[model samples]
Target: MTDSGPVLPWLVIRQDDNGNRYRVGRYATKDEAQKIADSLDDRGHKQLYWVERIGTPAL
Candidate 1:
């Protein structure tokens, strides 16, 4: 279904050591998204976490 509602532009992405990726969550602000990613990264796991703005290049 098409979503005419507001779209969350910020995304928290997680990439594991196995080369697999997952979407941790979405937010309206970049700071909020980055905070979530930072928290997850602080856990010290094999997975890598980062924040990305939707529609932008993935890194």
Candidate 2:
């Protein structure tokens, strides 16, 4: 088995009381992730956020 760190994609979604929601997904490729996020926003889902994790180099 291969060992994987916590350098994977993540999605953060926030919603409001007005029945609004937003989602943001992080991916190796920014475009792909943004697309998904935009789609969710279009569906009238509040806020969308995404973050990419970068691995640190061993000293």
Candidate 3:
């Protein structure tokens, strides 16, 4: 099966240990996403996640 989809790296920010996601943004590359995550980490936000698209299967 062939798959076609726009693959993007998503940055997720959490409020605390509760695992509640607060903010999310998508980037074209991992580097771009990492930059934002790094900045947020420097500011004291610990919970960060990288959600990557696995591409959607063609129908």
Candidate 4:
């Protein structure tokens, strides 16, 4: 039998009123994070982007 490791989730970035960036959280999938971003925008949040980590992993 072969062992399959856990798939790390995507990282999400969101900015507040003061332009300070913050990480919302990690989601099981990219779609999940997008959904949360949409919800934040609907709630009047600003500058939300799904950050794509490079070189080193976000986690």
**Each model's backbone clash number:** 0, 4, 0, 0
Candidate 3 residue lDDT tens string, 1-59: 12766655354444566866665677677678777767776786566554443353312
* Inter-residue clash pairs, candidate 3: none
Q: What is the TM-score of each candidate against the true structure?
A: 0.85, 0.41, 0.51, 0.59
Give the winner by lDDT: 1 or 4: 1
- The positional error of residue 17 in candidate 4, measured at the CA in angstroms, is 2.7
Best by TM-score: 1
Task: For residues 12-57, write the lDDT of model 1, one tens digit per residue.
Answer: 9999889998999999899999889988999989899989998999
Task: Kindly indicate the candidate among 3 and 4 with the higher lDDT.
Answer: 4
lDDT per residue as tens, model 2, 11-36: 44445666464544445555666666
In angstroms, give how far residue 23 of model 1 lies from its true place: 0.6
Candidate 3, residue 47: Cα displacement in angstroms equals 3.6
Report lDDT (CA) for all predictions: 0.89, 0.50, 0.58, 0.65
Candidate 1 regions with alpha-carbon error over 4 angstroms: 1-3
Please give the lDDT score at residue 25 for candidate 1: 93
Model 2 residue 53 CA deviation (Å) reads 5.6
Worst 10 residues of 2 by lDDT: 50-59
C-alpha positional error of residue 53 in candidate 1 after TM-score superposition, expressed in Å: 0.8
Q: Cα lDDT for residue 49, model 1?
A: 91
Model 3 sits at a Cα RMSD from the real structure of 7.2
List residue ranges in candidate 4 displaced over 4 A: 1-6, 47-59
Off by over 4 Å in 3: 1-9, 13-15, 49-59
